[model samples]
Target chain A: MEQEKRPEEVKKTSARKWTESAKKVRGLVANMYLRAITEDKPVAWVMFTLCNELFVAMDVLPVYPENYAGLCATKRVGDPFIDRAEADGYSNVTCSYARIGLGYSALWRDTGEIPPFAPDGGMARPIMLVGSSLVCDTRYKWFQAFSRYLDVPYYAFDMPGPPAVTAHRPDVREQYMKYNLTQLHGLVSFMEERLGKKMDWDKLDEIVRRAEKSYRLWYDAYMMAGRAVPCPFPAEDSFRCFVPAFFMIGEQEALDFYQGLYDEIKYKVDNKIGSLPEERYRLLWGGGLPPWHTMGIFNYVEDRGALFVFQSVYLPLNPADIPDRITNPLERLVYSRYEMGIRRAEHDRKLGLFGACNFVGLGNPLLFVDEFKVDGVVMHWLRSCRGATIGQIYQKRLLAERSNLPVLFVESDMCDIRDYFEADWKMKFDAFLETLETRKRAGA
Target chain B: MYFAGVDIGSTMTKVVIMDEEVIASVIGPTGAEHRRLANRVMEEVLRQVNLPFDEISYVVATGYGRINVPFADRQITEITCHARGVYSLFPTVRTAIDIGGQDAKGIKISNGKVVGFVMNDKCAAGTGRFLEVIADALGVRLEEMGELSMNSRNRAKISSTCTIFAEQEVVSRISEGVSIEDILAGLHEAIASRVYRMAERLKIEPDVVLTGGVAKNIGVVKAMEEQIGFPLLIPQEPLLTGAIGAALLGKELTLKAVEGGKPVERGTRRLEEATFFE
Candidate 1:
């Protein structure tokens, strides 16, 4: 519980605590579903969204088979599950996440301890598997397979693509709005019949309000991190940030956590603490969290008096700093339910925006140079992230033609340190920085 | 009358105002905040010509962030915008290879319009982002990667397809004291190889207009040109091609509206008023 501990020590302690906390939360959430199943409550296991909410609202516990599967993959527990799923005719080329989720379920049914949260010796409650077809075809079919294997009810919320782009076309936004509402109604009815409790519209509304508020607050916090001198927060911390945001999404507790973080960020911004050192050139990094191997890149620029001002990390889920103002709480809840379900578009947009806007034609790197009045942009074309690479060529070209500002597109990887050639990076970076300085002198 | 095209791309948003041809263009960073940047860039572009926002005849938006643009009268996708832009620049361009920072797209063009386009948006292997990653790994700047790659005698083979895995591979190579130039050469080749695969999917033909930020990296261009077994025609300003196309589209649409005796929409009218002021 000591705060003044070495980072390694802190990491070790936090890892254990986080693991335990995750297990506890998982169990608490799981028990509600077990009770519903035993009592013959109509329940569902959703990958990410309304089926889970409906199950929870019905007093039925909802299981996130995907999260468990992710854990299995990262922890290397899903190999057997994957083999079993593939043996059961699941294609190996399917989304790793879906394959792993179904594989976990297959293994869980065989060895009951697959989840590590199910009771010592009892049949899990009758479950429903729910998913949307927005991300990939795997989840929709994976859940269907899971439902058949478990002999439980399975529901799919179909999400048709946005209405074809045309003038005077009927707005499919309304259809989407209606589709979500209809699904929620069905889920609520199923929960009511199973849990034997009348649906509490007011309680659901309150949860939605709190969740929206929390999302807004998170957005605000992320924005604050974009200040001229941002907080020294590492992007790898997204894992920690995602945990509470995903699980405790619509809860006051989650809002409180974000609010507290916001206050801390506000204090830092006010005090100008955690600001990158003053630099003659201000650069912006476009791409995902630069892997640890590339962390030195930041220092290299900073040492050269070049500050990396802002990045694309702010696009996806609004940083928890912004406030949400939803007039109709139920409508907002319904929106969140479906919006969360159709998460791929949002994810792709965010990742794409992060790179395209920052590294591409009108990306963050160029914006940072203008905003910070810096001299150049050092664009990292991360090899690992294909989404981030989409717009770099346009970015460099536009930056050069419009402002004639210098941009350096460095190709590198995040986690694979072995591939990095430090001497080459240094040589190129030094030359680019020199060019920026020379250009500044000539312009002056 | 002047038409303006704003491409709010994923990485950078470009603004190009053309009075028949380009008059002024500004490209800037796409930060966590876009609407603000859009407004700021528009102001800067207008200031260059002493024009008001209400004088522009048309405002067209294209690219990933196009929908988020509040002031745009019409929003077009990058696929359409790039095709139009490239075709306008090179009438005979049959194939367009737009290697942006994060994505590599190969488009087949017919009559200055995109017939079919293939894009690799999922991986960074062949795109500008891959080069950026390798540049960072090799401790080189974007501008210098081309020169460094050219200097290398040895070509190191980097086998990792994933950026995360590639970083590890680069670091281990550096630890082994491999020449930096060789490492860069290998990295550039890897990116070109990946892009070659995407280009192959589209069955790219000659007269390919290579547009986007990656075109600036001579190393990538050389490798891709060699891989494709043909030379590429790069525009004087390749990055602005998307915005240029968007602007040209805006102009065409506006002229069509006027010729058809239809009153311009309120948004178009405002832009026209802005152009008048300019």
Candidate 2:
């Protein structure tokens, strides 16, 4: 008989592993609301994924619905929440990450109780919900749907997409950056009025420094993956290390967590040890985010003697990417927006594809294929994600025609397990390995 | 040396035996139990070839029940097997569209290898089972519906991409006094359009072959030619292609064993190591 499928947990690694730090961050996330209820502190649910650093700088407790949704997806326990969102008439076509958030908020609002499965007793009720534009059309809209459920005021910021700063439209980059900075300032004003407090410029300067150090260390650790042989930390560990940068990006703990991870991966690469025991194949996980329920997929690959040396879904923020060193918190916030918009323009104007675009969409695997000594590229085409799933067929054709490497596209959903079949994926993965081997033997 | 491949599909189980030449083969409905049907079919094929099971050089099991074939020495995916099977039958075939029981695939082939491929997103609109449902609704036998549809003077249009909704539309057309022949022709056209779009996504090339149970349907084959705008090379026995591919893979593995001086275990990880989370 087949063994009963189980959910993946954090794998134990050396040096009082970063998972311990990540777990601490999760506890702090739960405490965000605990303190709100106990100490009467104000909490704002930030909808923009990257602005958590700003919220931390404001010294207010911050709750991230996207983070909570990811937590459920990673635990493989996102079913009920996803179903609830669907029940609320949030079409199945909506992003599963957003669906989990929508369903979870509705459950708390309708039942007036927290879900038993919510990580750390679930998210804290916020005084307001903040949103932003992203690669998907649904990111900001999903938050708007949740604001109605919680009866909270929703404030959204514009986050632009690819094809930025074209030569034909030089003013486009300036407009996009200016729009984001305006949104950030409005959010700060809204929070200050609601919390009955003033902004802390000195502490904000300290946070800017800490966040700078944190993002640099995170980028440095990931770059070690490009070494001839990468560090032995499991692929999921990369996702796990993302916790601090997401929650406490400006805190000393974020820097400490990243430095520890960087040192460990560096040691393994120097010693010629790899994440997998045999390490016969090196794969590049590009194109889409990992589906939380089927994370067993990684272990399944690891056991097959393949090491996923690089996954493109990791955060692309780097300290060097910051174009401005302004100490003023508001100016620094405005500069960060300019940096993001300009990076997209540079990516278009120059072939700076490796810089920032790796974090989202196809990101063009042109540079990654050989730089990582990639044996093959495995990309998932998710039904719920429009931008991520777009141009996958074109990506495969171009990769094959240019690099002469096989690109296997797995079809699955992000958080929804009903859309995934374990047996089907395993067989497909097995066949993919066979194709790589067959190509290798043929000297193709 | 003898090689055997068992393809345990959702609707049917097929076994192919390969020697210096094609030895023997067996096909049966998969029924309620894959294990029992797999064992029965393998034994029957060996009996037809007058060979003992132990004489087989290597065994490969494929399809949805690949893991359930406890007796097989190796388990492979039907995707690779389908490519291998079609390549062996029609080596010049550069692209293959296989409409299996539960799913449909558009595979790009070059040098007798799968270079690129696409499968219908988890849906029943363009599969063999979809035809079965329509045939059952029309009170026509699955095989005879092909000839019945060939007689239609006018093919009605089927726009719904969902099999359930399309079946409901067929029922309405029936009550509205639409001929069963016209309705069946429309169903064929609908499935062909659905599958043609998937093939076009891979960019259809010359010498394309159509395989699987649906290949037996002349109406679907014609609809495919009309829709795909390319001729398809239908194999002598479409259903046996995946099983034949499995046998060829088994043969390749056996050759590797001869060179390496050790048997190969196909499954790379123990179930516990694959527990993933812990």
Tens digits of per-residue lDDT, candidate 2, B145-252, equal: 889999999888887878899999999999988899999999999999999998887789889999999999999999999987878899999999999999998898
Model 1: DockQ against the native? 0.02
Residue-by-residue lDDT tens digits, candidate 1, B44-147:
89999999887888888877666566678877667778888999999999999888866677777767755445566455677777877877877779888888
lDDT of 2: 0.74
Please list, in the order the candidates appear, how each scores on TM-score for chain B only. 0.92, 0.92
- For residues A130-236, what per-residue lDDT tens digits would candidate 2 score against the true structure? 87775567877887887888898888766554353352254754665566667767877887777688777688777877777777778777767554464465455
Best DockQ goes to which candidate? 2
Name the TM-score of chain A in model 1.
Answer: 0.60
Angstrom error at residue A65, model 1: 3.3
lDDT of 1 by residue, A1-444 (tens): 111111121111112111122234334334434564466544456666522334444455455665544444333344455556676787655544555556556655665443443222222444556676543455677788787667677767664444122111235455766776676667566556545679766666666667767777766765665543544332323333444455556655567767765676677678776544544765555544343333435566566666555454323343222226754554676555434323423333443432211112234444434544545555566553444455666666556555666556565543333335554465455545645554565662
Q: How many clashing residue pairs appear in each of the predictions shown?
A: 113, 2
Worst 10 residues of 2 chain A by lDDT: A12-21
TM-score list, all predictions? 0.45, 0.90
TM-score of chain B of 1: 0.92
Name every residue pair that clashes in candidate 2.
Answer: A8-B277, A9-B277
